[model samples]
Target: MNHTIIISKRISIYIIGLFLLSLGATFSILAGIGVSPVTSLPYALALTTPLSVGITTVLANFVFIILQAIILKEIRWKNFFIQLIISFLFGFFMDFTIWLTNGLPEATSLVLIIVYLAISLILVALALLLYFTANLPTMPYDSLTYVIANTWKIPFSKAKITSDMLNVVLSLVICLLFIQSFGAIGIGTFIAAYGIGKMVGVLLHKLQPSLKQWVYKNN
Candidate 1:
């Protein structure tokens, strides 16, 4: 019974994390300034394609999983398949959140823009907190960086930076080739890419003790 309870708790945390992550990403996209770097490519694709950003995100993340498998030169078929299911769930949650907020007016005024940015940052930080705490199957984009870092024997931080830069570059290329405009890549993209980590770090630092206590007490 104890083991079952612990497993249930962990699964609940993971589901909450996915929910917050999808909502946060939707908030960023709806902000209309731009999306985070990890999402930039998908957002760009959505502009030219008929699919919504949520659907494009699922497809892009699937490709990321395939790339990770290729780079690792070995695949854990079970985990790979599980991650695909999680990715689809995340994508559907994102679409649902976007639908919920579809009636929100576009952020136009200076105050509204700042408010949107602040909300986006906070929600993303909270999402990261839940994600790291759950200790579940890793997201595909994150797994790609991990696989690359291990394969190249480079620092994970360096590998992650490289991955993000590559994502931005790829998004730019897609924009140039198809849209002939850079509307999807803007200041918010860079802010999200860089600021979110710092925000998550600070939040985790401040909340770690309390979070630990909660987990231990629950256990």
Candidate 2:
């Protein structure tokens, strides 16, 4: 049987990973502790301005893309199309997930909140790993990591962890000075800043072999 519609295996994995990433981010915010360091600045802007988290995320990603060009000293528009696509999809999925999970009750206890945080960390880490396995162009935030890593001749994980910490610090300043509140810098944020890095390291060790077999680009 010849099918009119076909999808690649890696694209399927990417979509699944994207949805999980959105759901994970939603749960993180709903936990009321904090957002992940990667998203903390966007969350702060969302709280301080009329823009939703999705809008802020989109905008922030665009900025990151620009930063990538600046750092690399060139613009490869053809190669960057996937990054642009993923950026828009990330925002859309995040907002859609927030609305879809609107019925979840607010966490009132520390235990429940911690559970949500744990789930958020794992989902995010897994989502990223899947993205790697898919072998697609990464989101700008991650692309920036590669830019930094290659530029400095350092490991990707080290670059990413350091970037996460720096982003958290920048977000904290934005929250206190402009947002006039703590924004999203709770204990969970700190945990995610460091913990997610460790989790991703451990997960990647197991994921590399599987990832070698998957190639995401469309033929």
Candidate 3:
């Protein structure tokens, strides 16, 4: 496939992915659950530094990009731009959703909470679907762990678990220090995201049509 054409076709996917990411963040906020690691990092840094969340996220993403380039030399123009778009759009949409979802009661009843949780699950599934459908490149955090595992002869599953644990700890501490209301709901959100993402990947794989035509079209 022509890289340029693929980029054109996938740009909407990237945009919708960002929208889903932001939407997920909004749902988390509404559920009063903890935020994602990369998302939380910016908020944490913003608290201690003079930088805005947007700026901090850009810096963090760029650092990851550099690390990824060093560890895996597969960096290219298309992937680089995709990474940039992901980071920036995620930050921007997160803020937007936060503002939009604010002022609505968190959850008035158990049913409402369940409803919120269900929506969150769906949003996360959509995020993963769009993310992979972009067919551009994986995020640096994900790629970094994979590369480190392969290079150092560590178990990939173990590496991923360790990384996720670190993120959970960091997010918990930040939420605590900031006095954010992330409790069992936060854990639930994490589990739901994991489950939904896995399901999406499985389903997409099973349903993926032969790409000959799509690839040819892009070419």
Number of clashes in every candidate structure?
0, 0, 0
Q: Rank the candidates by TM-score, best first.
A: 1, 2, 3
Q: lDDT of all predictions, in order shown?
A: 0.83, 0.82, 0.64
Worst 10 residues of 2 by lDDT: 1-10
Give candidate 2's whole-model lDDT: 0.82
Give TM per candidate. 0.94, 0.87, 0.70
**Could you tell which candidate, 2 or 3, scores higher by lDDT?**
2
Per-candidate Cα RMSD to the true structure, in Å, reads 1.4, 3.5, 4.4
Q: Which candidate is the best by lDDT?
A: 1
lDDT of candidate 2 at residue 11, scale 0 to 100: 79
TM-score quality measure for candidate 2: 0.87
Pairs clashing within candidate 2 = none
The C-alpha stretches of model 2 lying farther than 4 A from their native spots are: 1-7, 205-219
